[model samples]
Target: MRVWISGGGGFVGSNIVRAAVDGGHDVLTTAHTFVPPPDAAYAVSKVDMTNGADVRASIDSFDPDLVVHCAIMNDWDRMYADRQASWNAYVNATRHTAQAAIEGVDASYVLVSTDWVFDGTQGGADELTPPNPINLYGTLKLASEMVALEAGGAVARVSGVNGQHLARPSTPRAQDRGFGYFVASIVDSLSANEPFTVWEADDINMVATPSLALECGEIMLAIGEKHGTGVFHCCGADAVTRRDLAELTCDVFDLDADLLDFGPPDPASMLAAPVPYDTSLTTPRTDRILGRTATPVRTLIERFREQYAAQVGEPS
Candidate 1:
């Protein structure tokens, strides 16, 4: 089967490419400008996701049996400060992907969503849980989920994504930081002997790259081949608090506990009320239907350490 994946250069997209190829599927992927593996099985193309013409042309040209909408304007912290750009990236990109898929050979679309879509209020949320996104980024993702679902696509309301992040650094600007740029920040803080803190009380879900992509790849193939589409989740069984995650990492690396910090989440940070104190997903339906489950947080973090050790050329 021919599969078209947007955001092919991203952590999730690249891993999906490998999974799809391993599954004997001909995969075609795209990057923002030029960001893909040098010798990737999937033919990589640069796409302006916000531009409908470009997105449409790419989909039409690929003529895929399935479409994976993994690319979105996900500027994590910046979205809270600048929502207009977020709208263009998330909402506009969704519009383009939907319109393009509608014109395809009845492509099965799978959109990647986030746990942030929930207003951090619900506990043990199910697939039917209506999204109460707290931030503009999550709000747009919810909107995009509706867009993809309306196009008769399956929406994967994913949780936190974690893995060794890789990208060709722009230039010889500064020292080479570690993988998982976000986690790297923590490592850097530890190296500087500075304090790094996170909300201790908030629950968070984390998924590794290979695990998340493998689940998505399998689901896309099944949905496309079987003509089954709906909402599914990609998250681990055991969820960890933000504070616990930092502490776990510190323990794994045998770093100083003083280098990490934790506290209650700022209630005012999100727009949704009754914030989902435990945004964990009961993925029984997902596991039963898809025959897949995401990796545990420990394994996910372990992989990161392996990759980190490799890049640093030293043992963790």
Candidate 2:
């Protein structure tokens, strides 16, 4: 398969790039400002997705059989702070990708979205649940989903992507962070005997980057093969609190879980917009479509340990 991923320099996209190349697919990926270290396996384009012409030209040049639109300004504060930029990147850029895919012969477009699309009023939302976004980020992503679906593309809603980005720098940069950073940061803090804190009140469904990337790759491949498209819930099998996840990480890494401090989430104080408390997604229908079950959260965290070890060159 010839695959193209926007924002491949970022965490989730980097994982997708790694999975695609490891699976023996020809891949082309893009970055806006922070270019990822070179990989012989795939080509990287310096495409700013917020620009329509740039998006179209890049996709046209790649001419991929599968296009995964992963580009977005995901920082909640930034999205709320600069709503226009976020809209351009998340909504306009998505429109460009979907337009390119719709025009490109035999190409399938997949828009990577978030569980934030739902307001989290009810736990365990499924693919059939209506999106009730609460913040700017969620609103834009939901709009992107509509654009993609309207253009006859696929939407894969994911949550809390955590794992190592293989193509990133060995010495971590500020932007080289993901949900996996939570585990990595805690490990580092524990190593230095520094204090660490985990949220006590919130719950989220966290998907390991490797598994999410693989599932997304498979979904894109299936869409290309069958020329089909729709929304799919791709997330971990279970929901866990920050405290539980932190404890599990400490246990997996042989750190002192007793040193961890618990704190309640105050979205109003910490975020520029309202955030979901429990955006757990259930993927039974998606599993049925893909003919596979999601990896358990504990198992995925262990896999994260392996990737984290590789990133830091430490024993797992």
Candidate 3:
């Protein structure tokens, strides 16, 4: 199967590209600003999702069997301030891509979504979880999902996505980037003999990149191939708190857990939307369809250590 991905050079899309390529499928990836991943046997093109004409042109030219749309502008900080970033990143871009898919592209589409749509009232939620977004980021993403549904697109709503790529020095991540990066920060702080703080109040059922891609690829391929699989949830092994997550990484990387500061999440420092206290998703329908549970957090963190350590030239 031939696949095309937006945000192909990013954290998740790159993993999807690698997995697809390794599985003996043809892939075409695109990046808006970042230099596209080095030209591999599979093609990586430059695409600007902000421009509908360009997105349409790229889809028409690729003519892929599957297209995974992962280009989201998730500036969560600006979401509640009436900022247009989310609208531009999700709403407009998705509507444009939906038109391209239904009228121009030949591939089946997968729209990656988020767990934030639930407003943190429930845990172990599934695709049937009613969406009541408390912030613009989730709200716009929900709009984007609705837009893509016009084309019968497959939806993969994700919560936390961890694991980092080889540090190109170009891809700088922040503490709030994802849980894995936060773990990385804790490691770095310890390495530097500095102190770091962590929130101890939530549980996570997050999906890392490759596992997410596989489940997404499987379901969307089914959807695109006329198998009639509708919406699905792509989640991880089990839920863990930030405190436990920190301790796990520390033990794995052999860092001093003593330097860590665990406390309740500082409300004032938190983002506008309430983070899910228990953000766990159960996708039995997804599992029945895909035939497997997504990867466990323990194994994922070990892989992260290996990958990140290698990037830092440390013997793993």
Candidate 4:
């Protein structure tokens, strides 16, 4: 199958590009600013997703059998700092991409969404649960979801995705830029003998089902291959809190747990957006559809450790 992926230079999209090439599919990908290293297995192009004409032209030129829209403005700090840019990246980009996919080529479309679409009053939300986003990021993501679905496309809602930086692997600490960068940041701090703090929402810690970017990418490909529609929960099976995730990272990387400190969530921190306290998701429908269970947290962390070690030229 000929597959085209948006945001190919991003954490999750880069993994999807590798997975598509590994799966023997003809792949075309787009990046806005950060151009990925050239690879013989697939093609990469610079396309402004927020521009309708650019998006349409790229899709029409590729004429892909499937188009997976993974581009999103998910930086919590940036979302609050500039709402208009976030809207353009999320809502506008999604609208243009979905239109190009459906109207230009009639290609099967799968949108990469997030579990933040749900309110934190409850966790383990399934596909049937109605979304009630609490922050601007989630609201915009929900809007993007609606756009894709209204255009007769599928939505793959993933959570806490992390992996090695495929686009700029040579850059020092490049893994600290995208979703799930906290894990790498923690490792970096502890390795440097510096103290690290994990924040909590009052007495309760924020929880999420973290998944590896590569695994999420494979699941997305499965959705596109099956021509899936509606929502699919593509996340880790284990719902862990912020502290638990930190402890797990320390364990996997054999770092010092004594350096870890606890604190309340601070708005002055890089995470300025109002995050849901517990946005963990369950993947029963995704499991049934893909014929596989979501990965466990420890297992995912172990894989991340290996990838990080390889990126840093350390023994895993």
Candidate 5:
């Protein structure tokens, strides 16, 4: 199958590119400022998704069987700080990409959304749950979802997505620094025998069913291949706290847990937007659609360990 993925230089999008190539699909991807390393398996084109003409031209040229839109302003703080840019990236980009996919090639479109669309008060929210986003990020994603759905496309809502940095393994982009990157940072600090401080707060301690980017990529591919439309929750089976995830990373990487200093988040550094306390999603429908259970957190961490080991040329 021919697949076109946007934001190929991003954290989840880069993994999607790798997943598509590994699945033996012809892949064409778009990158903005951060161009990923050139690989013989697939092609990468520098295209700005926020620009309708540029997005349309790229999709028209690729004429793919599937189009997965993953480009967006993913940072919560940044989204709150720069609302217009986020709007352009999320809503405008989705509009342009979905229209191009539908009109240009009639390709199967899948918009990569977030579990943040749900308010944190309700855990295990399903596809049937009416979304009431509390922050700008969620609001924008919800709007983007509407655009994709209106275009008769699928929405794959993933939560707390993290994995190895495929774009620049050595040094990830600022937007790419997520839970997985935090784990890597812990590993680096522990390897140097330096103390690493972890901020613990009511807002930041929200529970989430973390999803591995690689697995999410595969799920997105399956949704596109099946031409499934509607919302699908693609995330881990186990919902956990940030502290639990941090300890698990220490366990999986064989790092000293004592060096992790738990502290309160600095008031100055706290996010401006309201954060959901627990936005974990239920995936029974998604599981049925993919014919597989969502992976647990431990297993996801173990896979991350393998990727980290391979990247660092160390024995796992």
Candidate 6:
């Protein structure tokens, strides 16, 4: 299969690129600013998603059998600070991709979505759950998903994705970037015996990046193969509080649990957005269609530890 991915240099899309390559598919990837390190295995191109002509030209040129749209302007702080840029990245870019899929080729299109599309009132939200996004990012993603559906595409909504990647820098940032980065940074800090904080009230069902990518790739491939489109939720089987996740990371890494402090989440934090308290997703559709089961949190954390060790050249 010929597969093309947008934002393939990013944290999530990079994982999808690796997964697709491992699955023996011909892969093409696009990067806006951060060009991924060159790999002989897949083709890379620079694409500005905000430009309809750029997106259309790229997709039309690739003419892929499957196109997984994972691009986004995902920095929470920047999304709020520069709302127009965020809109262009998420809403306008998605519209361009959808049009390319609809007008250009018979490619199976898959739009990566988030559990943030929900408003947090319903825990374990399913494919049938209506999206009521509470924040600008979520709202734009939902709108993108609508564009995808109109273009005869499927939406794969995933939870917080965590795993180590070669693209991630060794130094920890002052603010949390995303769940995966947050977990890795916490482990790195705890390993250095540095104090770290976790919110007791914040909750999410975190999925391993490779897991989400594998399932999402297979689901997207199946969608292309069958010429079908709909929504699929691929998330962890269980939800955990930030506190519990931190404690579990400590346990898995044999770090000092004493250095971890628990606290309430501050909405004013740099990582702040309209995060749902409990956006755990149920994946009956994924199970029925892809024969996938929800991965356990412990299992995912263990995978994370192994990957981290590999990336850092340390013992697991």
RMSD of each: 5.3, 3.5, 3.7, 2.8, 2.4, 3.2
Give stretches of model 3 more than 4 Å off: 37-41, 77-85, 166-170, 177-180, 201-228, 264-269, 314-316
The residue-by-residue lDDT of candidate 4 on 166-275, one tens digit each, is 76665344222123666877887888898887776542327778888888888989988888888998888899887888899989899989999987644445344455
Task: Name the runs in model 6 displaced over 4 angstroms.
Answer: 81-83, 168-178, 201-228, 265-273
**What tens digits encode model 1's per-residue C-alpha lDDT throughout 1-316?**
8888887667666556656888899888878865565765678767888888889888998888888888866455667677777787887787787768765556777887767677666655777887787656667888888887887777876655444444343322111111123354555567667777554443332222222334445555665666556777776666665555666667765568786766544454433322344566656667677766656766666666776677553332
lDDT scores for all predictions? 0.64, 0.72, 0.65, 0.81, 0.82, 0.72
Give the C-alpha lDDT of model 6: 0.72
Best candidate according to lDDT: 5
Which candidate ranks first by TM-score, i.e. highest?
5
Mind sharing the TM-score for model 4?
0.90
| 1 against 2, candidate with superior lDDT | 2
TM-score of 2: 0.87
TM-score of each prediction: 0.76, 0.87, 0.83, 0.90, 0.92, 0.87
- The superposed Cα distance between candidate 6 and the true structure at residue 223, in angstroms, equals 5.0
- How many clashes in candidate 2? 0
Write one digit per residue (lDDT tens) for candidate 3, span 1-316. Answer: 7787787666666666666776777888777766653546678777888789888888888887777788877456665555676677788888766667666765677777777676666666777777777557667878888887777777777656555542145455445523535666676777777767776544322322222333344445544455333567765666666677778778878777888886655455466454545556667777677666666767766776776686674422
Name model 5 segments beyond 4 Å from true: 38-40, 74-78, 172-180
lDDT of 2 at 32: 79
- How many pairs collide in each candidate, listed in order? 5, 0, 0, 0, 0, 0
lDDT value, candidate 5, whole model: 0.82
Candidate 3's TM-score reads 0.83
lDDT of 1 at 279: 62
Off by over 4 Å in 4: 74-85, 170-179, 203-205, 265-267, 270-273
Residue 154 alpha-carbon offset, candidate 1, angstroms: 0.6
**How many pairs in model 1 have backbone atoms within 3 A of each other, for residues 3 or more apart or on separate chains, i.e. clashes?**
5
